[model samples]
Target: MTPASLVRRSETWNFDIDAYTNPYTPPSPLHRFPPWLSRFLGYRKEQKEDVGNVLGAVWSCVGTVLGLAVIAAVFNNTASIRAHNPPALIASFGASAVLEYNAIRSPLGQPRNALLGHTISAIVGVAITKLFQLSPHFESVKWVAGAVSCGTASALMLLTGTVHPPGGASAVLAATSPEIMAMGWYFVGLVVWGTTLMLGVGLGVNNVQRRFPLYWWTPVDLRELQRRRRRDGRADVENDVQPEKIVDVVREGEEKVSLGGIRIEAWGVEVPEDLVLSKEEAMLLEVLRERLRKRGDDGVLERVPSSRPSTDCTMVLSRSGRSGSDTEVLYSVT
Candidate 1:
């Protein structure tokens, strides 16, 4: 294979962490539940549109109320927490409820973000505030401590890919609120408890009508992607595939060139000529194409019933000579 072809092949089939980390619809486990139970669970491969409708609005309100109420009840009624002068219920969770209930589809609303964001921010906030306390003039510069904690938490959240907006408030509260400061490291436990309770309620309530979390850890199934990559790698090594074979695969169908070397042909679907796609969108499409190609190679496509209507689509990625000229073709045989 030409150096360019080898690079293109590696890019196509190689396992990259970021590729599998991006959000995508994963297969739902709720299908295994009894039909009636599954209906109530509301797990789906596709998310329902979050349009403004009376039923959706009512469900959102219900989820918000239930989540907050559950947390409040636990914190307030618990004898140990009640003994403390100030209640353990933190204000930042009110903002979290907005995302978890109202903006259910948002990445910020997902479990990973909601839990880690609050916990990490709480830790940062408490640690910074404690350090400030050592200065003896903590009262004079407590606001500065709050600002520093919030800023540090923001950076940490971004780096961890768990950027929930409410997390910043949690950090600020930990530094500025006397009750939270008095709790010190114990505040971390309270944040965790509140966040866990909220997520628990979200799972039961939000899933009744619409999906609360689009994904738990990641939207893409990383385990399956890794398995496929390993299998493909083994096959490539065993076959000692030649460059000519790779070229032939790219040239299998009739060739048509397009701008940016992206050739998309669809039979039933209408694609706009002036369509502009972001890099992330292009990468996602590439991942979908890879999945289709893998299914075809495994004879999965051949097993489909022929009586059903289907469409033939092809996508070709070609690079110019200056950019290591090469072509990779993907076909969806349905």
Candidate 2:
């Protein structure tokens, strides 16, 4: 073929093999330090900080105190209520509810998680203990019954879209407590009261913290499974590339597959084994981490993984939402 024909053919079959080059590499050190402009203006770019968290905690306690006071007023005829003593109720039950709220939302305060989790769990605990008391047929198997009840309660809570960590305590509390046993199924009243009090406090406190109420019912992430179809003509090749076939090829001999898992065994990294941040931003992560652990401060890096990141953040699509946004923080969403 003539040189002109060769040139035309090469142009006709154009390809860019390296299609996924990321313009952004490891983040810059300067980004860790906020530009003077941001500090001066106090621009709130993210919701993560001590501000909302601290205030949310304080208000939850305040709400708990107020709830106990309301109860004391209603039951004024009782001997304990006669002396106008709200101390025991407020200090024990009310205080625990607040701590329980903290337990539900602390570290990562996913809103919808706390409400139903505690409510359902508290009821389960009461049920388990009550079931043990009435187990005439299984008199010697109360312990096993209680455990199975707890496990069943746990599965129910997880299945029903509420997985509050503290609620497990609530369930166990009702199941194991002598006082709870005295109350019997009447402990359902306690469950209702505690749940109502928590919901009220969470709503009020979260509002002051500027958290949207919809967050309580909305999921932070959604999972989607995709199916791909092959071209009509390629039966054999299509079979090889089917979903299960692809999985077999990739996972047949591999037991573990994570960035850190590969790094230690393949690349010989020496840092504490779990920091598997991507190659691009790993340095910045280590720097901020060391600053916090050794120097006792978050320092330059404000926050990391404080919220659930959207998986879309990792892809290099036509218009990345944060393409030109502030560079100080980088998110890991893979």
Top candidate by TM-score: 1
Model 1: CA > 4 A from native = 1-42, 45-51, 235-334
lDDT of 2 at 93: 44
Residues 1-334 of candidate 1 have per-residue lDDT tens digits of 8999998888766434445444243445766888666644445655557556687788889988998899989988888776664554689999999998888888998998999999999999999999999998999999999999999999888877788999999999988998888878888988898999999888888776676677776666655876777788865654453222211122223222233534321111112324434334444444444445566666554322222122222222333324554434222221
Residue 189 error for model 1, in Å? Answer: 0.8
- Residue 211, candidate 1: Cα error in Å is 1.7
The 10-residue segment with the lowest total lDDT in model 1: 264-273
Return model 2's CA RMSD, one decimal: 26.3
Q: After superposition, how far is residue 102 of candidate 2 from its true place, in Å?
A: 3.9
lDDT of all predictions? 0.69, 0.44
Query: What is the C-alpha lDDT profile of model 2 across 1-334, one tens digit per residue?
Result: 9999999888876332212221222222322457443322222346554445577667656656665565545445456334433223322245445543444344223444455665676678777766676768544665565576567667776666565555665566565555555565555555555455555654554444433233334332111111111232333443333221101111111122134422111111223223323333444333332333443232432222212122212211122246786444322223
Instruction: Give me the overall lDDT of model 2.
Output: 0.44
Using alpha carbons, what is the TM-score of model 1?
0.61
Model 2: lDDT of residue 43? 23
